[model samples]
Target: MDSGQEALTLLLLAPLFFICMVIEYRILKKRGYSDYSLKEVVCNFSLAGLHQAADLIATLLLMPFFLWLYQFRLLDFSLTPVTLIVLFILQDFFYYWFHRASHHIHWLWASHIAHHSSEKMNFTTAFRQSLTYPLSGMWLFWTPLMVIGFPPSAVVLIVALNLGFQFFVHTRIVKKLGWLENIFNTPSHHRVHHARNPEYIDKNFAGVLIIWDKWFGTFVEEKPSLVIDYGIPKQVNSWNPFVTTFHQWRTMLTLALSTKPTPFHIRLRYLFGSPKFADNAEKRGTTIK
Candidate 1:
């Protein structure tokens, strides 16, 4: 039942992740970038374990659904290079929308917030993943490929590959790759994505292709005028991985349930509104208007 890529990627990339982490650390240390801290790295590894474990469990649970959907596909897709290439492009397209939705929708943001909780940016920071990402509507975004006849196994493998490529882009050590920065998701684009600055928030949602952000009008160049401030607008302020994972959910639930005296529309807004709308309301001394 294993997509070969799962075992293969773990076998290969596990060591590669370690080596890359060491390389990035050395490179940053040589350049005198001291943002990488021990506690944050521990949390990153712990979160990565939880995140991948959830992905494995979700794959087993959802395999049947993907298989069932495959039967209904209008056109059968092979795992040939041409097909995989197309799906990779297609998957990146779907990823942009899913990533965008996670930013704007509170329910999804609860799961995604953990990834942006880290104050430091580095290759290891990419491992700061949400443990509940499967339930955050990530797999739902890839469903169209299954319905379009990509084999369940191929769909799963391609997703893993997309993520594998994404891990390398989470660093500050890399500069713009000249023309490559325009077409693909590079460290420059991804740094802007991870940045909390006003211009960077909710921009550059593409997983592999920077073109999606460009085409969708969500692209922003890493500004020379403004420094990239990494992490979420409202910092989590703790190294507890559990707190990092579920703090957003707690805030969302408290707001949603505290609307006993407020209107029904406000409760709905609390549930479905922007990531920090409830907190922002309290900050501004205004109820949902």
Candidate 2:
């Protein structure tokens, strides 16, 4: 599917998104949890708009490259229900790595940080995406599916479905779903992913299935005694959509410029190294050893 049709697929689901958000908002409000705010919701959807626009433009520009790259496929298979299921699993596998890398690599974290910038974990928090994903090379993660002989359109559709399924996992409304939690990414698991708590910081990177995290040793069960604190380590501190969207990028650039008279690799590290490296370097006024 082209970007237009892919967008329509998401659009058809927009009402569902809105309805979930509304229900979650009402429940949280009645329960006396201050998870939603008008300012944050507006900013969240604003970032969503920016993210969608960026994705649409990037998809249009990169479709031909994906198509050209498809010619070099190692294998070709017709799209069947079984094949589609396989593709979905493969896409989720790739997404697990992509999500993991975004946490570990500063370059990608600059784009992903915005999604975790909000302290709230309402349904709208899932809408808080960064426009910098295209620049950060998120699409490259899915190119492997194309090279593996899946049609680019099929890959894109599966990606949309994967992300759509993820929206439900962002809420705090649902508790752990017994056996479902064993195989799927539940709200509890995702809350751990969004938590700023030490043990939860890099855990639970599953896009849809929890098995990837379990297999890779990144899974952490939510602790009832340990209250989850949502948001990144360094808070963005602003509800302004633009500020939140580019705060980490600005921070990364500043770190790169401030660490001056250093080796070229050190400067690159400011942009590409772990975010912890950047944070510590900025604090100590020197590179991480």
Candidate 3:
């Protein structure tokens, strides 16, 4: 879809987003998960808006590349209804794996940590995207859709729609939808994804479907007794957009450069290991060596 069309769709979907948020908040209140303060919600969403603006600008600047890919044979030109549905599903499926990798891979985590840095779960949190994702190979994961004959327009539309669907999943309001929770990614499932608790960490990586998490062994049920602590263990407290995007990158680069003659394995681990691996090494009194 063109940028104008995408913007129109987002405008149309805005109401539905608010409706879902209200429904979710009511549910969370009923379930007693509504302990958060208004200030926390405002702060989180404000930072998220800044991040989204940066992302919007980046995506706009890169539209030419997307157009070129579409004009050539690299991306398909078909736009039948069936093709569109397939494209949407394919994009989401790839998103599931990409989201999972962002948690598992250290370098990717450096780019993704901004989203999880917020210690709150709300619809706005869903908008907390990484401005550095374009530089982090995130677009490469969706190339298969282009290769499989999805037009660039269709690809972009499906992506935006997929993201629109995910906005509802970020809230703490919706509890369970019976079997729906098992088949689809809901607020309940996403809460687990944002949790910092031991058992909740690195779980629930579905975008629109919960089946992906179930099939991949990353699914975890929400436990009321285990209070969900949102945000990374080492939080990035700054509201500055630039700081949020490059803070982890700076830290990782420092660690890598400071380790002289680093073995290939350690270098690879530094790039792909879990976020906590470095801290765990410190706790065990180990260094690169």
For this target, which candidate reaches the highest TM-score against the unseen true structure?
Answer: 2
Give all TM-scores, in the order shown.
0.94, 0.97, 0.83
Which stretches in model 3 have alpha-carbon errors above 4 Å? Answer: 1-8, 18-43, 67-77, 239-241, 259-265, 281-287
How much is 80 displaced in model 2, in angstroms?
1.2
Deviation in angstroms for 164 in model 3? Answer: 1.2
- Give per-residue CA lDDT, model 1, range 106-195, as digits (tens): 888999989988888898888898878887768899899888878877777778888889999999888889999889999989999999
lDDT of 3 by residue, 47-142 (tens): 556555555666677777776665556544557787677777778889999998898787888888888887878776776677677677776777
Candidate 1, residue 136: lDDT = 73
The residue pairs found clashing in candidate 1 are none
| Shift in Å, residue 108, candidate 1 | 1.0
TM-score of 2: 0.97
Query: What's every prediction's RMSD, in angstroms?
Result: 1.9, 1.3, 3.2
Residues 1-289, model 2: lDDT tens digits: 4876556678889999989988998898899989888899999999988999999999999989999999999999799999999999999999999999999999999999999989989889888999999999999999999999999999999999999899999988899899999999999999999999998889999999999999999999999999898887778788899999888888788878763567778778989989888888877867544
